[model samples]
Target: RFPRNVQLCVLSFLLPSDLAAFASTCKRLVSLCRRDQRLWFSMCHRRWGSQTLINKWGSGRISYRRLYRILDEYKNLIGFWRRCGDSAAPASSSPPPVFFEWGPSYIAGSRVFPSKNKGYDAMIEKPFLWMSVAWNRKAMNYLDSDGKFVLNEEDLIGESGFVENELIRVNVGKNKITYN
Candidate 1:
């Protein structure tokens, strides 16, 4: 095994999934990855893109792992919602509670195709974090890097608002999403 610095440099090239798999193979690798915030930061910058971190996270002292996890959660949740359908529509002409199965979702180029995933139900059980939206109308897209969220205009606006490039910030906790 190389020194910690060399280990970190080597580990930096691994994707999050690859890193996790490598870390699981031994305690030394796990400790090296977890204890060094710089490694995680490098991973964050690599996966999410640098400007994305600057725009969304700024220079604040935030955990890279936490940021990555929350972003993953958002992607999963949006995928679930998109698959479930018509978020603006009422649950059944009545309101009490509504629930549905999970779905698959993906972004290809600038477009997002909605589908189903059974794992969505699991997302609801996780704690709420925070979300940020970068609304780009000319490009017709909505983005949240931390939550791994991206929605095209049709999914979010449904042909109504004057689409413009703007950033919307919201905090999701205490069972609510509040603008900041």
Candidate 2:
């Protein structure tokens, strides 16, 4: 990036396609390459424009120019992560905070009595995951059936045996919190 015509500099020094091969050739190179975002970016971005490369270059998106850009971004030597496959598991950039929430009804031994509790309406019951992806640091949290902040309310209820979740609800005159 220092030299104005530096675009041409990488060609003589490091070709894009050769970078991955070079990175694999030795440990030092791999370490350098890992720090170099150009290779990783190319590897990642290559998946994006496959059709364009085939139409124009008749090959992959690999090129020397992109490699230098990656080097510039990664040369400082910081952390890098490479995903081997589709990572479906939940991931967070930062460790989650120590959290405690209500335990589930199964652990609480409080079953919604359905028709037995005619005073209440058990019209519909289905489970869905509501996440608090908008936490203080933009993290994910889940909301339970009653639209509470905590996904599991068992901890909030403690060992007290409440038959229905609404019984403990702070709203609608159900604030009868009692512990077993």
Candidate 3:
């Protein structure tokens, strides 16, 4: 077996999925590569170029491995959401009215306003990098940066008026497509 430094240097070039698979190969490698603080820090830095955000998320004694797992899991979920349907066609037979909130960069909700386009064309115009797009027949929900579905919550103990989503739209387009 190579030294710890060599293993870390090699693992730095691997994607998170590849590194996960490598760890499964043996127990010793798992203990070595998975827990290497420097290796995980490097991976996180390479994946996201913001050290301040990383430090904040990694606060409260959270290890770099755990932070990486959280970010990787979110990315995997988005990938799965994207691959669930064909993008060539519209995500649904009819586009549902989408909500775009311009606020402190942490709110998710859909609002119905008059559109300039005729006949009420439905599309999600701009999606922040930290948000996820999901939809059901009744509504399209954009999850927050923490991967939680954003919605207004009324005071409990009475009939809460929030509706749970029945299905997630698989073919939501990231941006509008204008054919020539």
Residue runs of model 1 more than 4 Å from their true location after superposition: 54-59, 74-130, 133-180
| Runs off by more than 4 Å, candidate 3 | 1-3, 24-26, 50-52, 58-60, 76-180
Task: Tell me how many clashing residue pairs each candidate has.
Answer: 8, 8, 0
Best by lDDT: 3
User: Model 1: per-residue lDDT, tens digit, 39-129?
Assistant: 8766666755533442234223346666555445444443222224456767654322222211111122122222346454432222122
| Higher-TM-score candidate of 1 and 3 | 1
Candidate 3 TM-score versus the reference: 0.39
lDDT of candidates 1 onward, in order: 0.44, 0.32, 0.46
Q: Indicate which candidate wins on TM-score.
A: 1
TM-score of 2: 0.19
- Against the hidden reference, what TM-scores do the models get? 0.40, 0.19, 0.39
Q: Which stretch of 10 consecutive residues in model 1 shows the poorest summed lDDT? A: 101-110
In the predicted model 1, the residue pairs found to clash are: 71-146, 71-147, 102-117, 103-116, 103-117, 104-115, 104-116, 104-117
15 Cα displacement, candidate 1 (Å): 3.4
Candidate 2 lDDT: 0.32
- Model 2: worst 10 consecutive residues (lDDT sum): 101-110
lDDT of 3 by residue, 58-92 (tens): 22246777766655643432221222445565666
